[model samples]
Target: MGQPSQKPPSQKPPLQPWGRLLRFGGEESEPPVLLRRRELTIGRRRGCDLSFPGNKLISGDHCKIIVDEKSGQVSLEDTSTNGTVINKLKVVKKQTCPLQTGDVIYFVFRKNEPEHNVAYLYESLSEEHGLAQDSFEANKENMFHVTKDTSGAGQGDEPQFLPPLPTTQVCFEEPQPSTSTSDLFPRVATSSMEPPAGRAPPSSPDGEPNPNLHLLVTDQGGDTLSAPEGVRAVVEKPDRMEEQLTCCICQDLLYDCVSLQPCMHTFCAACYSGWMERSSLCPTCRCLVERICKNHILNNLVEAYLLQHPDKRRSEEDVQSMAARNKITQDMLQPKVRRSFSDEEDSLEDLLDLSDEDSESSDVSQPYIVCRQCPEYRRQVGQLFHYSGPGSEQRAMQAPGDTPSTSASVTPAQDYVCTLQGSHVICTCCFQPMPDRRAEREQDSRIAPQQCTVCLQPFCHLYWGCTRTGCLGCLAPFCELNLGDRCLDGVLNNNNYESDILKNYLATRGLTWKNVLADSLAALQRGVFLLTDYTVTGSTVLCYCCGLRSFRELTYQYRQNIPASELPVAVTSRPDCYWGRNCRTQVKAHHAMKFNHICEQTRFKN
Candidate 1:
């Protein structure tokens, strides 16, 4: 009975291979194509419903773009009195004008009453009015200084100085690339200097205006763009914008973006996480990579550009108008039908409204030390190390057991004020500025009170303690009940090689003796130490083939300049900097030529 239904091993099943396979995710997964080449935006923009409510500037067919398939043209329509513009070109009412690549379409909207500044879709090019007239490459960040009205209330709108940044480009158009076989990508301007010097003017063959700002004409097939000399067309060139400022991941115009580094390619915020999930390497440049670490500059840059895009501003207006209109409609329908809030609901709302946390002011104190080693080692801490003292630099120069805490000769307590200490955490203690209480608060503030490094969860340190590697090296809190001070390092078991285990554990966790000693008591709690070997090991290996190093590595090595016999052979003979692939080969060949037994037998073939 069990074998009755079984088919013979040689019998083939009936085949029906007629249905089509819709391939999605797998090895053939869309072939990792650029999002643009697929002719699509990562996400569709949601168009607002027609007709909005109170204080509404424009709604219900407010802005429209009609695409004509026959003519390959796009026509713009704006009900707002100001105008509808694609790029900066004002669209004539019914004209079906041909659209070019990278065109920035914008609409201007001003509310009926004199309320918020006219909610325009796109800002103008005038650097004066923040119009989009500046070169995209040029620094266009504007600065303003605001002053308080001091009427004993709070912050005021009155400004002391409305200072502006160096006026530059609001937008830039990348000229049509040459037809020749030379590299198509725009070459980054070369410089003679790498360190922080100043950018100098480039020498032009024509000896004319700055090429960066000049109106260089481009030949599109036989047709040439014939705008007035120095009159750059802002409206007609979204293609150029697409080329220069597109998100590397989405291939869309960068809305809010962030640049991935060591490879400085920028990608839209939505796309970056996915791209980084695959690999953090910049998609445009095929270079080695690191993780998506902090990038303040790129974050700030994208934030600024997104502030200018008008599409989002207009959408927000639609939602607000609808809400207002609905409120009015409800009031008109039920003038006398007010619903009382439930007692339980009111109680719940009150609890939710209460503040769990506020933007509590913190005293950020900084202390500085001289030795380059400690400060350089403390890049994870950043600017604080520059301004704050008590680093590897300070520790080395200190007298034997010279405590920073004891050094502070305290005066009697005066008017109570908050002070940020030299350590990293914002002062939880008070409202006034925290002083570098180095002598007083050195050891106690090393780490956050009871946070565990593994779980990042806080525990009572009294019960918890270092268990695996022993309490000597692993000061991490764990309980003797949960974990006895069992020594993986044998420090508790008293192994002869316990120091080796302790060193390895500390190196892996970036918690060396020097780091612990230098940290302010507060820093230890928050965990603000560099998670890397502070000691410049035989220098860094930038290019393994050539044995090269980085500026930081050399800086660390030359800093001490230990005698050759004492230092490792690698640190002694390492190449100063990264040699390009070609240069590295040439240099290697030259050196090998001097020590070739094979070359001695066979005359040089190269």
Candidate 2:
């Protein structure tokens, strides 16, 4: 073949620098991703090249990007639940749309989810006839050098040298005039020159120095010339003395001043008292207030100052009046006492008697009263009573020593009644009837009633184990068996210990109880009585002979091959006809004959 007559060498086309740079996470987020590949897949799935795990609205296979290398064109196709948006417009699903430089892409149309949106900054390789790539590489190198130089420049006390950054021409829009005088100067340009040594630059009419450089010359005597009289110096005035003494809560002059302990921060007694009910921290320093006491000295001083300044007295009176009204409203909303008993006729007498006793005594005279709800009693007399309801004469006639029983005829006026008659109080946890305190006191004089730290309700330790057990985290008395044991001790209603134990056992083995429970409940909900325990040991094994043989012959083979663990522990199918056949009896007979195991139908309990 004449050594293959020398053919002309073909020149390879120059590799195009065209690629899409995806800028995601907005301005305050992470850096963008530079896509060098011709194809890009975006979705929540791990297989996708660009995954958006933070976007729960996105589907598993959301969208795809295809780049045409020859044409330098890029396109995106949406295959997601919410679909995608291009340049603020929704893109059709499964349809490719060409994307250009500066095109914005949103995974979803939801304006609330800004994190899923991205912008594109395209760099066309063909720009400047292939000179774009060379310029980009040079600019990137310059940026790297600038970054490295600036990072190490600010370390020493002496200023380090930095290469001057390349300058570019900036265009400004036409300025519009406004009422403000500052708006007149809108085109001030910056200069590289510095002012002369030792002399300060001249300031503008606003008294602020001009940010731009200005040249100034000083005389031989070194005396500086003052700026033109048009520029006036601004002076700030001191705040009025009364402004410093204003209470933060009422925003007025302090009255009945009370100082919070530890910090000694003062506030109006009524304002601080109401605030202390919600939080025990000082309003100023946020320090814990162990206690708050009336600042008599400060109170007298403020009083004297107000007396000297009569104009402020009216404002002080208005604030004090408002505080008083707020205190009254709060008192009305919160119950003075948490009634122990529910609405019932038999408990009406005891509730009325307690209310009567409370009304008879002054709140200040009584120490803290331990009630079902409130731990303290400091409200006005009779505030806790609800006496509008009809009284029960039968309950009133009954002796105090008699044990009260729930009566159908008796009805209570209020929702809560004092169930405790004389000394008989109900258990806060279990609601179990406790022995009379009079009887208990006679039996053991030294023993006293214990109280729950959380509810602050008194419960007898002798009746319900002990109320002293408290949680370390909150220091609150949480019933040990109920909270600590997850209520697995059958203390709560409908508690199933067996089910709980099984769930705990599966959880310990790395199996989720929710999955197992969901699967089991689904079958039960479908009315499927078959009890199938799919253990870790895959599927049940079947004999080859049984597979080929008839149903009658299969029974004998099933007996020989079935495992003990695979056998159903219980059946839930009805004994009556099911699908025109007795499913319960059939399953029972089949299990009994095949595995020699007894089958008992059981009811499913939640």
Candidate 3:
């Protein structure tokens, strides 16, 4: 009877679909299309699985969306003439790229008239993906908001599309008309070289009018801008500051910014980490990436920018993806020893017992070397090493067959003298004795004593500072660290490579290294160059090459600000180079000597 009443098997719930595409920012919004099939074709023609008849640019078979069964990874294959854009990145025709959740797909991009553009907001339907279809549907009304361009380009006539970013957009309405620009904007300026109104133009210390100053005066009507008397309107177009805040690798705003050392160029930590897996060279400058450190300053600036432009902030799913890929950590910020101190430091009683056991087991004495510069040295009985000399201050070899006692000795008749001869390391820069950190190095290379990154030679400045036992004055000067610029060309002159232009310029100006330092100091004092908190005028936390780079940059800025009257007449009279510092012609001594490379490029693509 129990077998006859057995319950029927319960039906299983339907499996969640993998992907969906929601049409956005056109003449009208449409319901999202589920990507249920393994491969689906999209086009303008009726034969295609996903057809958009309104889009004239789409071909009969424009692109194919593919979903991997096992991995749940979705990818897009573009086959259209107009091309497909995934999150602002144009996909090469016939190539496939894996699509991430919240990626925007554009069949054809029309910068103006976004309403005419064929666009789709890609969403992964999985709840674990953090972009469930219901969440997108719930916020559908406030999804795509087109606003006026804030870059002050084209008189703010063109509308800016915000849907492609896949982020939360807090709508910012137009500010009410106000007399004060500050009321309307945190910073407001025309896309011109003319300095903003109300701020005094920078002048030289001698009270001479700055030749570089191009102040524009607006009429009372405020409809037109005009240059002052004898001041030519430079009419330099403004650069898009927004581009500077984005990572070149991801083509998105930076997150967890990390700077590539030697180059000092910053990028998103997760983006750069992915790049590093393929190659160790910096993507922007092509410089060899030596070390990476968090760019705290740039991170702060990025946070500030995101606060102002909330729409540019990445979605939670994108943030989680990037966090998983991030390789840089706080541990990379500082050097650490290989082993924990707790493991290295045992009880004194235990150490004494071990020493006694060692003494009883062996007749030969173990040798230990101490730094001569150390403050105190004592030869304890049954110790690993012993010092023998007639004078307490002088160091010599111990007499043969002089066995050390196993027991502790009485108080010394005179003050104990520190010996220089036993088991000490020599400072790479000063050739002076210092404590050996070999034990720490043996445990972990990252925690090893400070050394020159280029030559791999140990320095005592950091080692002595850490120990807090040696005199600071005994350490070598910071300059011995060989501080240089990003390229490290002029300062680190080798027979293999040298900057001829730098050499000739120094010679022409009758400037020595001392003069360069003086000018850099003067630049700092005059606010021509600013230093971070970690960096002092004479001391810096940066490595030798980086420190030198700071000085080199400051020196260049100082030289650029100097009036023509102060410079050589021939140099001032030389025609300005069109390509500026980026000129390939500068490699030739004749071209470098003929034109100034410190100024901005006058000739650019229109």
Candidate 4:
């Protein structure tokens, strides 16, 4: 079996004529697999050129290493469940990736542990590089333990691994005429790399190999046209790009494409937005969608493809339906700043300034109107007031004797009309209709409606000049409010573990809510500021008591800033808590009395 037979030179070119795989890892001593043809399949299949019979991960027909004879370009097309990896990059199943020199191939690269799974180092071979048949025959017996003679030439009963000639002298054998005996082994009988029985090889209409056949799908009987050199540039056919461009959700051409993050799977923006209404996971990968962003690059490619095939363009009705379904936007990925109540006031002033500038300046008698969104029942242009300064005569306007909130102002009119009339949202507080401007100002915190941290529901708290009845404050109270007890009562009252921590801390002190309030008031009177005095902004979604405990823990930070002379004598003399604010023992009554909790940690031993 190891003896080299006196065979004539092959007439047809080899599948891959420029590269050979050097065995490594599991079989470092084995002979190199010679790539001698334009395409060589490697797997467990006996008919495969490079068969791995023992490896379970390697599929029957795992993958093919294809080489372009004229261009000398090498590529690996993956076709296995375990998949193939070249140069650390996993080749997508059924997709091709160009191979490069020094690329390492892995059959199954385990993430956690290294295994003896077969690995190969790709070496690009030149015309000068050749392995003599004698050197390869030395290791033939061990390498052909599983490989058998599929050709059935009746030369020997013992199986032998018949590899193609070395890269430097590679050749493809022409297909022999069919015979009755050869028909018995339909797949393995022929050594020639020809198309399967009855299936003609894919080629251009001019009887030449299609240069862009890889881009044009052949499984669906795609038409192959050969354009004359100057007639048209050979771009990928639109049909070939259909599968890549089509939206997985809608099963149509992608319109306003968007990509889900983490997974990086793409779909139509409207399709995904609608899908998110029911589930936040990606439709393709089932992974949680952390963020969504416009796939501008894919959108551009889709647009180019649609330009070539206008029929693939979605109709106006379908486009509108998609637009209506779209809820998520690129703004969701934007960095959101937790806005304070003052930020809204600044935006309101800016809007007022703009409105004043737009009014006619010629007539001094004509009063300049500010809020057009407000109803006629509300304050008129002449009645509007501006808050200049303490010295200025202007003062905040007083509500009408009837209280405008009680009037029809809170209710939407039967014939109300505006640019965004259909998109108006009723304010939860005022019960008044306010135009939803989130779509227009989503990227800007100053203009967008502030959302509650706990509920994540957008509230009509900003000054839109249309209504002033809503809670015009940072309803998503922060640590500052929690520390000062300014947060609305009962809003976040809940029985939870975080709340229990606070309850235990207070109970151990034998102090009621009134006692704590009085102490905080006394501290304010003595000019002993808490953490909120230095930092006025921050948001939280924690339950009421938990928020208080978080603020209480932060109180030590402000106390540390005070000079010993400025600090209270009790706190100045009290020993600092070993774990400081992060003290797990703070919840224990004995530890709370032993050490001062209003100071930074003295030891970081833990």
Worst lDDT run of 10 residues, candidate 4, spans 214-223
TM-score of 1: 0.20
The estimated TM-scores of all candidates read: 0.20, 0.23, 0.25, 0.25
lDDT per residue, candidate 4, 1-606, as tens digits? Answer: 011111222687634447778866544456667777777787654457776554434555678888655445566776553446554434434545555567687755544235534677887785432232233234323221122234545422322112221211111111211111111112232121212233322333443222212111111111112222222122222234665775655445678988877788888888777666545555666555557788889989988888888855765656777789777665454122223324424454344332222133443433332223444323343344334555232223323211233223222222322352234455454445555555656675555343444445554433232244433232324422323333212111221222333444456767554454445444544656454434222444332344454445333333244366644465456677687656776655466656666545678765
211-260: candidate 3 lDDT, tens digit per residue: 22211111212112222323322232322445577565554568889897
Please, what is the whole-model Cα lDDT of each candidate in the order they appear?
A: 0.29, 0.38, 0.49, 0.46
Between 3 and 4, whose lDDT is larger?
A: 3
Ranking by TM-score: 3, 4, 2, 1
TM-score of 3: 0.25
- Ranking, lDDT, top scorer first: 3, 4, 2, 1
Better of 2 and 4 by TM-score: 4
**Per-residue accuracy of model 2 over 25-76 as CA lDDT, tens digit each:** 4454544454556666776544566665433345546677766555444567
Q: What is every candidate's alpha-carbon RMSD to the true fold?
A: 31.4, 33.1, 27.2, 24.1
Q: Which is better, 2 or 3, measured by TM-score?
A: 3
> What does the lDDT read for residue 552 in candidate 1?
22
Candidate 2 structure, TM-score to reference: 0.23
Q: Taking the tens digit of each residue's C-alpha lDDT, what string does model 1 give over 448-520?
A: 2333233233222211221222223111221111222222222211222222334454566666433322332
After superposition of all CA atoms, the RMSD between model 4 and the true structure is 24.1
